[model samples]
Target: MAEAAAKQRSPATPRPVRCIVKLGGAAITNKGELESIDERSLRSACAQLRQAMSGSGDAAPGKVMGMDWSRRPGDPADPAVDTDGFRGMAGLGIDTNFIVVHGAGSFGHFQASRSGVHKGGLHTPLVKAGFVATRISVTSLNQEVVRALAREGIPSIGLSPFACGWSTQQRKLVSANASQIIQSLHAGFVPVLHGDGVLDELLACTILSGDVIIRHLAQLLSPKYVVFLTDVQGVYDRPPTDSNAVLLREIEVDDNGGWSVVKPVLQGNKRGVETSVAAHDTTGGMETKILEAAAIARLGVDVYITKVGTDHSLRALKGDVDTSTDDWLGTVIRSAK
Candidate 1:
C-alpha cells in the first residue's frame, strides 16, 4: 500500500518540448570592458527566459516589450519574481524542457586576445597562460549567470565545453557526450552551456564559439525552436546603424536549395570580416551567428534572431503571433516550404 502511494505521488515523465535559447555576448556584456557583465541586461534576459520556460500561453502587451526592468524593481508583473509566492505558467498546466547557451562576451575575449588563444597550435608560455586565463574568465561568468537564475528560482547547471568536449585538428567536434544534459532536463533542471577554451588535437587549445556550441547542441537535441537573443532586432539588409538599413523579417533556403539574400550578410564581406565584432573578439560575431542559425534552420528547427532584454521576440518564439503572419517582429529562419 505504501509503495502504491509513492508511485501515485511520483511526477510523470515530462514530455520533451525541446527548446534552445542563446543570449548573445553583445546583449549580455559590455564587450569593451575587460570581464564586465551587464547585470541589468543579464537579469532582464533571465526574466524573459523564465517566462518563456513557464509555458505561459499569453504574451504581455507588445508595448512592454523592451520596458526597463531595473527602473521598476518590485513590479508584481516582473518576471524576475521568485517562484515561491509567484505561480508560473507550469502551475497553470503546461510543461517545458529548455537548454540555455550563452556567449563569452567580455569575460574571455580580451584575455584570449592578449593570450593569442585563437591563433591555434602551441605558442610561447605567455600564450599558454592565456588559454588558462580564458577558461577561468568564462567559468566565472557562468557561475554568475547560474546565481542570477537561482535568484529568480530557476534551477540550472552549467556545462562547459572544455570539460565535456573534444575537437579534431580541423576543429571539428570529434566527440561530445550530452547524456548528463538529457538527465538534467528529465530531472527538471535547465542545463546551461557556454563557449570556452577547449583542448584541440593540433592547436593545443582554442576558443570554441558559443554559436558553434548552439548548433552542435541543436543537432544533438533536435530542439523544436532555437532562439537567438542579440543586441539588434534581427538581421538587417545592411548594417543596422546605417540610415537605409531594414531588418530582414525572414530568411530561408529556397526550394532549389539556394540561400537567401541575407546569406551574403551572414558570410560578411569579401574579406569575411564583420565591423560589429568587438576588436578583441576572436570568435566570429554576428556573421557566424547568422550562418549557424541558417544551418540549424535547414535541419528543420525553427530559428529566431531577435533582440535580447525584450519580450517581443520571446513571445513570438512561443507562437504568441503566427510567424506565418506578418505580425511577428523578429526574423524567422526555416526550411523553405
Candidate 2:
C-alpha cells in the first residue's frame, strides 16, 4: 500500500503552452505615460505570469511572452513589475521567458508631439522628428526593462526590430528573428523585444508595436494560450464607469457587434505618438488584438483579455476558471468553429 501510494503521489508532468501573453502599459500601473510604474502591482502581475509558466503545483508551466520589456538601449524607465516578478518566479523553478517590446513613455511623447507627428497622422513635418524621438524613448524604456530582468535570475537579453525585422510593401513583416527567439526559449533564456525605433523600408520608416511582435510570436510558437493583461478589467460594454458598466464574458471573432461594442480610448499623454487603428482589421487596439487572436485560433490558441488585477493574472495563465462564457474574468476572444 505504501508503494502504491508513493506511485500515486509521484510528481506529475507539466503542461506545455502554445500561449502568448501581451501585458499592456496600463496593466502595469495607473500612470499611463505621465506617471512612473507601480513596482508592487507590476511585480505581482509578473509573479503570477511566472506562476503560470512555472511547472506543476498551484501554477502551470507556460511559455510567457513579453513581460513588459524594452530591448533597446534608449527605451523608457525599467518596469519594476515584470523584472521583479521574473525574479520571484525564478525562485519557484519555472522556465520564465519574455519578448521585450515597449512604447515611448515619457521619452518620446513630448518630442513626437512637438514635432507634430500625431496631428498629421502617419507622416508629416513632425513625422521625422517623431520617429527620432520615438527611437530615443524606445531605447530608454528598453534600458529599464533590461535592468529589471537582469536583477532577476531569468538570464534574458534584448533584441531590436530595427536591426532584425523587415517589412513588405503590403505592410506585413517580411522577415524577423523568430528562429533566434525560439532558440533562446529552448535554452531557457528570455528574448526581449520592444516597439522599435524606426525600421527603414523600401518607401519609409515603419513604426513597430508590441502587437507586431505578438503576431509573429503567435505564428511561430503557436502557444496554447494568449493572455492580454491591460489596465481595464476586460473589453467592456461601453467604457467602464465607476457607476455602471458590464464586463463582457466572451467575444467571438464572428460575433455581430465586435469591436463596435467596446471603445478603446486614446487617453495617453499629450506628448504621445498616435497610430490610426481603423475599425477593420488593423494593429494597435482591441479590434486588432481580437482579429489576430481569432486568426491564431485556426492554429488552436486560446486568447484572454483581462485587467492586471491582483490574483486574476495567475488564474488566467494557469487556465483556472469556472466560466463557460467567452470572457470569464475578462473578455474572451475565440475563433468560430
Candidate 3:
C-alpha cells in the first residue's frame, strides 16, 4: 500500500524533445561592420523559430506575432513564460525545449583579432584590455538576441560564458555547470549562451567558440538535435564562392566517428575546395564547424548545418530531407551509430 501510494503521488515529468540552435555570426551580423547586428535577419530568424516551437503556424498574415522589445518582465505585454502555443506532437504530444547559443561575429571577432585571444592566454595589459572589450562586445550582442527572442514571445534569459564557464589554460572548456540551463528549461524558459572570452588555466584568458560550447552542452544535456545557422546554403564540395563549387547535401559519420561526404553536382570547373578561416573571423570558420558537428554526431546527436535568412532552418528543425528534390535544403550530418 505504501509503495502504491508513493507511485501514485509522484508527479509525471514532462519529457520534452530537447534541441540546441546556434545563430552563426556571419548570418546574423555583417562581419565587415564593427558590432553591427542585422536587425531584419535577427527578427526573421526569431520569428521562424517561434513558429517552429509553437507548432501553431498561427503567425499573423504578413506579420509575425511577437511582443514589443520594450516590454519588461512584469509588463502586460509580456506573455506568461510557460504559456507557449506549442501543441507538440499531435499524436503523442511532447513539448519542445530549445537552448540557444550564438556566435560573436563582428562583435567579438574584430576585438578578438585585435587582442589575439586565440593565440594564447592574456599577458600584456593591452591584450587584457582587448579581452575585456571582446567580452563587452559579445555581451552586448547577447542582449540584442535576448530582446529579439522576447519580441518573438520566446521566454529567454542570457547566460554568459564569461560568468559561468571556464577553460583549460589551452582554452578548452574544462568545467561548467548546467544547473541554470536545467532550471530554466524546467520552468519553460530558453537559456541563451554565446561565444565569449574565458579564463584559461594555462594562458590566463582565451577565446571560446560557440561551436565548442555546443559540443560541451550536447554531451552534458544530450539534446536530440544540434542546428547550426550559417550564411551559406550548407556544406559545399568547395567554398560556394568558387565558380565550380556545389552544395554537399548530407554528411554521415562512420561508427568510428569519421565523416562520409555526399558530393553534390559541380557548378563550374571541378576543383578542390578549401574550408579556410575568413579574413576577419578569428574563430576557425567552416572547418571548425564541420569538425564540431562531427564530434557531436559521435555522441548520437543529429546535426544540421543550414543557411539562415531562409526556410532551410525550419526544414532542418523539422527533420525534413528534401535534398533529392528541387526544394533541397541544408546539410544534415548524421552519426552511423
Model 1 residue runs over 4 Å out of place are 1-17, 58-96, 254-257, 261-284, 317-321
In model 1, state the lDDT of residue 42.
Answer: 87
- Scored against the true structure, residue 20 in model 2 reaches a CA lDDT of 63
Q: Name model 3 segments beyond 4 Å from true.
A: 1-17, 57-96, 263-284, 322-326
lDDT for residue 55 in candidate 3, whole number 0-100? 64
Clashes of 1: 1
Measured with C-alpha atoms, the lDDT of residue 22 in candidate 1 is 87
| Each model's lDDT | 0.68, 0.54, 0.72
> What does candidate 3's lDDT look like per residue over 1-337, in tens digits?
2232233321444334368999999888987889899888888788777767766554453333343446555676744443243343232122338889999888988888887876764678778888888889999999999989877767888999778654555776665556666677777778899998888887787888899888877776667788898888877766576765656666767656456654443344222332232211123498788888888887788898888868778776655556567575777787765
The candidate that wins on lDDT is 3
TM-score against native, each model: 0.77, 0.67, 0.80
Candidate 2's error at 302, in angstroms? 0.7
Each model's number of backbone clashes?
1, 31, 3
